[model samples]
Target: MDPFEDTLRRLREAFGVGRTRPAEFRAAQLQGLGRFLRDNRQRLQDALAEDLGKSAIESDVSEIIMCQNEVDLALKNLHTWIKDEPTATNLFTKLGSAFIRKEPFGLVLIIAPWNYPLNLTLVPLVGAIAAGNCVVLKPSEISKGTEKVLAELLPQYLDQSCFAVVLGGPQETGRLLEHKFDYILFTGSPRVGKIVMAAAAKHLTPVTLELGGKNPCYVDDNCDPQTVANRVAWYRYFNAGQTCVAPDYVLCSREMQERLLPALQSAITRFYGDDPQNSPSLGRIINQKHFKRLQGLLGCGRVAIGGQSDESARYIAPTVLVDVQETEPVMQEEIFGPILPLLTVSSLDEAIAFINRREKPLALYAFSNNNQVVNQLLDRTSSGSFGGNEGFIYLTLPTLPLGGVGNSGMGRYHGKFSFDTFSHHRACLLSPAGMERLNEIRYPPYSDWSQQLIRWAMSSQSCTLL
Candidate 1:
């Protein structure tokens, strides 16, 4: 027996009755979402703190504010986003009105990951609502505190007939995927990404996967070491370095690595303090299983700085590894923790070649005092997002999108792009039904003159119907 069939059917029924299609309805849903964020700010922050040791400020900036912005943008532009767009006409259809209609895909399923649970779930929910589609949100079960709040509270704010929050782990998700959905958006690892894609393929469902990868940062010999160190350390260790877009590893020469070591040490101390485990800015691993996995990774290379681990607290200090081999475990996988490995490459060409050889990352960074070096790295490499002499600060811009290419992930969403992703642009034309004389001339009776006249009328810009 299918447990979700009834719920799915109800949402489908609501969508079929045009419950989500109106501009006012979409605006109201978005406004309600914004209010939810506004009214429950501290509760959300506390949930994040419980799950990942995330500070209230980090929770606000990275997750809460970003989601709120998407809601605001969608509500402000709902009517404009829903309007039919006019298209150029052919000569044969001079009197006809041709336009593209942006219509909803009925019901959509969004499966969010644990790293940024609230932001990932709500951002895509914002798009599905704005595009006039009923949504089924599956929050990560691993982030139990956040998941409980969303499952209980978010539904109260949203129209329950069109919105539902289902809770589950891998087993329940597998069952959920067995049902047919108009669209599916997943955020997680590539291994799970393949499973989601495979499941989506069975139903011929369209999916937007936001998966993780080993995001690379290339440091040039011409750059300032302390500047590079601070940027890399903060981004790498932010949210205990669980961010999908954070710089995962460093590629520089042995000389630059030497300069970066103490600079990184200085930065880590400045940000998290001498005892990083007690530092409120630092976060612990998500769970004991993940802590064990990260603990095993510490033996990969010579630990340059901060290699302390406390299994009881799930704490692994902000660490930097040096003289690391590409074939080591730390280098083999996307390190989703507060560990940054510095691997030495001979030159910029070598660094670029290194990045190209692997799967394209979700985000890539290159730090240099010279513009030519930055350009060369940018020109040679491909990633979902790029940062020059900075970190993932570009995520602040709603105009820019966030996604991955190749093995990293697929599809994009943020601001207007989110609205467009959930909508289907359908080509339509309205032509006259009463022009019998004009219609009859082009039908049945074929002659040399008729053929020439019809061809000219259809193809020529200078000619039209009588």
Candidate 2:
């Protein structure tokens, strides 16, 4: 059989005619997932370490435990999330009951990235399962150990017919995409995201693209330098700066830079110690290619603090660069490694303009104690989401909808948003028997009197009945 056909057949068999009552079974499945994660925490962490060389704590926080949290949250809130939402009806429809029914998209394909493989895959998986859809998960092959573990454990713990992991590379992904699905959720680089969207377009399937960008963090002069520096340093180097929402670069006034960079340097030293290479908290680049890419960016910008690497280990120290121009490669793209570029701006307007000049980022951050400055920045700039005086914390909150706009990405999914993402808001209008007279005005008729009456009745200012 063809690969596409094989995948489709497997999914169909798993979903049992693609009609499982998601509302009835999602809570139990989520509970099972939570238990599965708790029962096999050590094994999952070990697998992540083997696959990506992630430290135990990083693996736990970024992957396994995160998935466990999502499962627990889904289980706790499934009932409220799954209920049909009642909507306000207009006067014309007052005799009719109007409500929105959240119905599942039949089959969904989730293509997750290598960085935070488990969290990215399972978080969306929770939503798909919660919304009562069959899922075909394609975990990143680069993290083969984690991929293998998930493929093995998922079938055992969950409904095998409703959820299955397909393990392979680009070829496998290509085959999987050949068969049309009701929805596709992909989290990856912008270039790859575009390809996924284009392929999805052929089938007219809806998609949620969580693409990356050069997310910027603005540190205004009025803010406390030490506090901003500490937060910035921690977020910039978190997960070795591999996060899609990690502060890609910083924009601060030249005077603030003098104060901020030194504090940032101190924070980095404090967090990773004098030698970050041996620091347990510091992580390595996922592969040699990424290491080389980050190493190459160091040349484009002047080094402000620690610019070093170990290619064999795929290690790059928490490096900082100053006086970075827009022409620099680091400034040009998403610096998805342990590198932070600091650019000086003369005014907040200049900072806002710089951010506006680029594609809308997935997350935009501003650090200011002044409410007016915060309001101005929020009003002037547009992003997928904004965080005030915080970095990357927006993603930690399960309540907010996380996504991108413009080139950064399209569509969003998190908590209830995820359920909404996989669900089609089907509209139902039930008209009362007495409202049958109202329908006469909408029926086909060519009389001038009928046309005039119809126009008058449909006008916003008029309240005439048919």
Candidate 3:
């Protein structure tokens, strides 16, 4: 028996009946989502703390606020986004009105990751709802607290007919993937992404895979070591360094590496204090599996700072590793924990070569006072997104898109891009029934005079209708 069959059928019926098609219905759904976040803010924060040891501030800033902003953006632009977009016509269709009508894909599946669970789940939900689709949200089972909150509390705020929160692990997810969906947006590793892609292929369903890669951070000698360290440290260790876009490794000259070491130590100490484990600000690894995995990675390179770990607490310190080789395990995989590796490069060209050699990362960072050096790195290498003299601050803006290029993943989403991704842009043309005279030129009676007239009428220069 298919466990998800009944639920999927009910949602499909709801969507087919146009319960989610109206602009008012979409807006109301978005507003309800906003209320869910606002009404249950504390509960959500507490869940995050329980699951990942995130402080209230980190939970609010990284998850709640980001989700709220997306909801607000969708509401502010919902009417504009739903209206038919007028498109320029060629001479071939001068008398007809053509435009793009954005319609929902009927049903959407959003499979979120454990890291920033609320943000990843709800942000995409905001888009799917605003685009007028019945949605199935599969929150990460690893983050049990957040998953419980979503399963128990979230459905109360949404129309149960159209929105659902299904809970399960890998086997259940595999079973769920067997069902067909109009669209699927998954956030996780590339290996799982491939699995999702393959499952989606069975039904010919389109997907948006937000996968991770070894995001490289390049620090040039021209910059302030303290500034780079602060930015890198804050982002790298944020959410216990589980961010997909966080800088996985740093490439810089030996001199800069020397200068950066102390600055990084200062930042770590200042942020988390002399004893980081005791600090309330620092979070822990998600679970024992991840903790053991991160502990194993700690042996990859010579530790320059913070190599401490507590298995019982699932805690790994804000660690920095130096004298690491490209062939080392730390450099080979996406370091999704609080471990940052520093590998020295003699010049800018070497850094670019090193970055280009690897799979294009989801995010790349280049810190330099000189604009040209940053620009050179930007022009030379390719990544999903580039951060210049900063970290992943670009995610805050709705104007920019968040996605990957090659191995990192495919497809873009966030704000308007999110709505577009969930909605299908259907090309439409409306022609007047009385314009049979204008259609006469397209009829098939062979004649030299008519041929020249038709040719001229269909030409680019003949766009003006007579």
The best candidate by TM-score is 3
lDDT per residue as tens, model 1, 316-345: 999999878999999999899999999999
Most accurate candidate by lDDT: 3
Candidate with more favorable, higher lDDT: 1 or 2: 1
* Steric overlap count per candidate: 0, 1, 0
Q: What order do you get sorting by TM-score, best first?
A: 3, 1, 2
- lDDT for 307 (candidate 1): 86
lDDT of 3 by residue, 1-466 (tens): 8889999999999999999999999999899989999999999999999999999999999999999999999999999999999987776577789999999999899999999999999999999999999999999999999999999999998999999899899999999999999999999999999999999999999999999999999999999999999999999999999999999999999999999999999999999999999989999899999999899999987999999999999999999999999999998889899999999999999999999988999999999999999999999999999999989989999899999989999999999999999999999998777868777777888588888988897676776553
Give Cα-based local distance difference scores for all models.
0.92, 0.84, 0.94
lDDT of candidate 1 at residue 414, scale 0 to 100: 87
Looking at candidate 2, what is the lDDT of residue 171?
Answer: 85
lDDT of 2 by residue, 1-466 (tens): 5755765777776566655565667777777778778888888888877756678988887788768777878888888877878876555666777898888888899999988888999899899988988888899988777788888887788776677778888887887787888899999999999889889999999999999998888989998998998998888888888989888888999999999978988899899999999988887788777788888988977898989888988889898898788987888889998899999999999999999999999888899989888888889988888888988776777899889999889999888788889988899898887757777766786578878866766675564332
Error (Å) of candidate 2 at residue 173 is: 1.1
* Candidate structures ordered by lDDT, highest first: 3, 1, 2
Quote the positional error of residue 49 for candidate 2 in Å. Answer: 2.7
Please state the error at residue 375 of candidate 2 in Å: 2.0
The weakest ten consecutive residues by lDDT in model 1 span 457-466
Question: On a 0 to 100 scale, what is the lDDT of residue 400 in model 1?
Answer: 88
Q: Lowest-lDDT window of 10 residues in candidate 2?
A: 457-466
